[model samples]
Target: MEKTTRAAFAFLLAACAPGVFAASSADLSVTGSITPSSCIPTLSNDGVIDHGKLTAKDLGRVTPTLLDLAEIQLEVICEGATVFTLTTFDNRAGTSAINPAHHGLGMINDDQKLGSVAFTLFEPVADAVPVKTIVSRSGGARWAENAYLGHEALTSFAAADGPNTPIAIEVLNARLRAFTIIVPARDLTVLDEVPIDGQATLQLKYW
Candidate 1:
């Protein structure tokens, strides 16, 4: 298995004011882990969802269009049990929104925003036991009862089969839904053939 490595950047921001020139600051912390445990990740349909060909007439001018919902089976199996969460690194940065719900589709000519894509996680099975997507705002103290596919924060996670904490189960299989949309015609004028490229990297984070 390959080694997983990561680095974090922290920043302190202070609010500036004239009358009350007091320093009000907050800590920006990034944390991740590289564990000895390793997992094999796989996606359904050989990880390919082809839309075939498209023309300007297929897209909209004022309003963006949505492609049909695509389903993919996501499975991960570790050599041994380990606790981890999947963190997504959007490859097409600067072309999408900062909101965790959206990831940028590749741009046209490296300028115009092409569109966006989002993934939702569901129907999870861990080590033959049913699993739910749960988040802990209090750092693993409590977790959500139900898990919905949405943009989970870096601090959020999917709970274990029967515990508040996420356990490193031997195998995890889940259904994933991906949403793809096209940018408004006003922004993206596909004068020529352009590739609908959207990429993201998902790394397992050890808690």
Candidate 2:
């Protein structure tokens, strides 16, 4: 009986060997594009939007209060006229529990909800031409106008479609309408003054 059981166990081990249950391989269709020139993008004041010092009392006791609008001049200087669009990576991702459009203000911890900031992109001009912002969710065959640029189709694939016409630009200019909103004072546990640390990275999506 023991020899029979051992034989069965050995058979099971052989069936479960490394190559016995191999996963089927699938083809990885790689695709990419090569662009001719590059661009140097910069923001005014090094892209810093300072909210400055704000007392807890300055924040509303209950309702969210909007801070003064901070502006950062957006400019992209290119080697030649090239098609490109911009995308934003939330530096403080997942910290914005309240709003998706609003980038995060760093938390005090896991529980305490900090504040949020939302910005708008406007006045886009490329190569001295008013290159109005447009989006194509339909694989670049058609494009519809889109003013917003927070992780929408404007920033995803359409921005980098070289074969299809992308936004042509040797130089690009735009303005960020940034507004910081402070949470209600009572919602936070105030042992001392806290710094509002909010950040995001704007990437130039190109082909």
Candidate 3:
């Protein structure tokens, strides 16, 4: 009887090993785009305007003016990995990304609130100094407008919690590469003359 029981147990173990001890596989590929869907206009402090809206024409020969990139960003956070990229009005660039900062490490920013991840430059561009730019809506009141620099004090945005909400990635480096701006709403007209509130979008995708 003992020999019979032993043989039965051995047979069961051999049968289970192949199915239970099999190697697993995973496809660790995440994909998305940095689509900033909001924008508004504000006056540059040094400019002649003190308490009025900034116009597109007011922005001199600088191809990319202040009112131009009010909604641009440099870093965007998503599941599995993070991304950062530059934005320009002349070209409609989409989803063209660079290598992951921390790939395969499963680095995910659980923090819902997002801070400025791009660094700022101090070079003078066509007479424009490397000062701070304030972000605000013109219609009602600025929801939250602060300078966007890694080291500077800036307002943070809330996370989406779900898959739909916009998720922004944390900036490992404190450097602003190129310029970014956003109009948070649909109406570009309001962003035209007065400091009225409007909505557009901006995001700094990883390139």
Candidate 4:
């Protein structure tokens, strides 16, 4: 499988200050790194991963116990006003063309759902736009996890069966720019490394 590249960059924006420094705009910005590749490292379905019990031998396999895995961590900052829609795809299903809640629109896990893969957006500040939609593979409302207006510095959700999952994020306002990290593996316990080709699109809606 082909390896994905991980990278990071810092962006700065100038904005007017509201206080004593009103004469000039302040340099507003967010700093972070894009670790595209890291071990997703999954634990046993019923046990903790840290114990290191999930291995080929445990599953009656004769191969070595070392599992190949990796993960992608993307850090982004919205300097000012903006909105975004983030979605993912499980290769077992279709492409990003399908909505996030197609299979279900509630919690991450649902029996009707076929393959599993989920995406969560994290915002440090309370002013971030709530997740408007979490489309699924079946093209219907499957889950409806409520929004945490406050008291949550960051929000996140996990996905199972993500080997061929497609991750995507779309911003409502052109003011926001996005970054990505793509890992070469999923579910560390399985030890199966899959290759993924990442793509993006900025669709403008006019009505």
Candidate 5:
């Protein structure tokens, strides 16, 4: 009887060993590196472009109304000569009356889109040398000169005589022109004071 009991206990232990020692968890790791170089970007006028007050009568009744053109100076200073690009983010995303490429001016009545703003970069100078503006729609895989800086595109500067490739620069200065358009008045509710709220952020990306 003692031997039989001992054998039964050993069988029970073996049967439960796998259930007690089985792996029921896993580990995940996240990692990234911080570059020693950094860049800072600034815009003129504290990055504010006020369209001023406009009455409902000033808006277009059937067609989209074109607002005045605004220009701001963009400057980028790097810790050292670095290859980088500029990308834009629309704070008022998905509200553009036109398309995703354009930045949005807030909506009206909670659902009706108000308008959009388009940006273009021109007259870029790098390290005191005149450079051409280049844009990459494929996340820096390929580049083209004098293209519109859409929301999905990256903007960089290249030497005037060089091919359409981004270059390293310590300082960069360029002109950003903003073209704004309001949706047709018929599509919006202008009963109250509707503000034109358009905001965007320009980001510097290492190439």
Candidate 6:
């Protein structure tokens, strides 16, 4: 009887050992290609839009004040012909007095919202050929002309013949226009000198 009991215990241990020690495995794949061509993007004036200064008298009391339009030159040069897109990120996010699609101008006293700015691309020239500005909200799947440049949209230049398709180019030049609007004076505290702190990043991506 002792031998039989010992044999039964050994069988139980053997059956449970496989279940406890068994390992499950999965495979992971890391794959991507490095392109030989690269592109460099630069903006005129070091990408700075100085609004100088603003006083309470310059701002509106009940309506939003519209500042003068600002224009900046954008250039993208590539080692070789390459397809790319341009996007923007609002550094002062969540501080825009207008809609979220617009870039923020920062806040006052860490509570009161300041203003907003909207960017538009115009007169794009790629490889010395005139091209139109095309934008895609669906991650390059589809593109259209005359779309607003926002954080969620991708901006690219299309050849004149191909109105909605992006083309590879060695160089691109475009005008970036910014329209700014300040919040109403009634919604802000103008007791002190408040700086119009607005910053944004224009990013380039390979397609």
Question: Candidate 5 lDDT, tens digit per residue, 1-207?
Answer: 999999999889978897675566788999876767899999999998888998888988999999899998989999999999888889999999987889999988999999999999888999999999998888889998964766789988899999999999999888889999999889987788898999998888888
Question: Candidate 2 residues 1-207, lDDT tens each?
Answer: 999999999889877896877566879998998888998889999888998898877889988888999888888898887776666788888776457777888888567768888767677766666656665655456666665555444431123224334656777787877878878888888777787888888878774
Residue 125 accuracy (lDDT) in model 6? 91
Which model is ahead, 1 or 3, in terms of TM-score?
1
Evaluate all candidate structures by whole-model CA lDDT and list the values in order: 0.68, 0.73, 0.29, 0.25, 0.89, 0.89
Model 6: weakest 10-residue lDDT segment is: 15-24
lDDT of 4 by residue, 75-164 (tens): 333333223223333333432212332211121122222121223323222223322322233322232332211111122221222322
Ten consecutive residues with minimal summed lDDT in candidate 1? 5-14
Worst 10 residues of 4 by lDDT: 149-158
Task: Give a tens-digit lDDT track for model 6, residues 103-140.
Answer: 99998888999999999988889999999889998999
Residue-wise C-alpha lDDT for candidate 3, range 1-207, written one tens digit per residue: 999999999989978888666677988998886544322222133212122454544543423222322222232223432322222221112211111110011111321111111223222111122212332233213423233333112222322122211223432212223232222222123322333221112333332
TM-score to native of every candidate shown: 0.69, 0.75, 0.17, 0.22, 0.83, 0.87
Candidate RMSDs in order: 11.8, 6.4, 20.0, 21.1, 7.9, 7.4
Show the lowest summed lDDT stretch of 10 residues, model 5.
18-27
Ranking by TM-score: 6, 5, 2, 1, 4, 3
Which of the two candidates, 2 or 6, achieves a greater lDDT against the reference?
A: 6
- Scored against the true structure, residue 187 in model 6 reaches a CA lDDT of 94
Q: What TM-score should be assigned to candidate 6?
A: 0.87
Choose 3 or 6, whichever is better by TM-score.
Answer: 6
The segments of candidate 5 whose C-alpha lies over 4 angstroms from its true place after superposition are 1-34
User: Evaluated with TM-score, which candidate comes out highest?
Assistant: 6
Query: Compared with the true structure, what per-residue lDDT tens digits does model 1 show for residues 22-46?
Result: 5579999998767787877788888
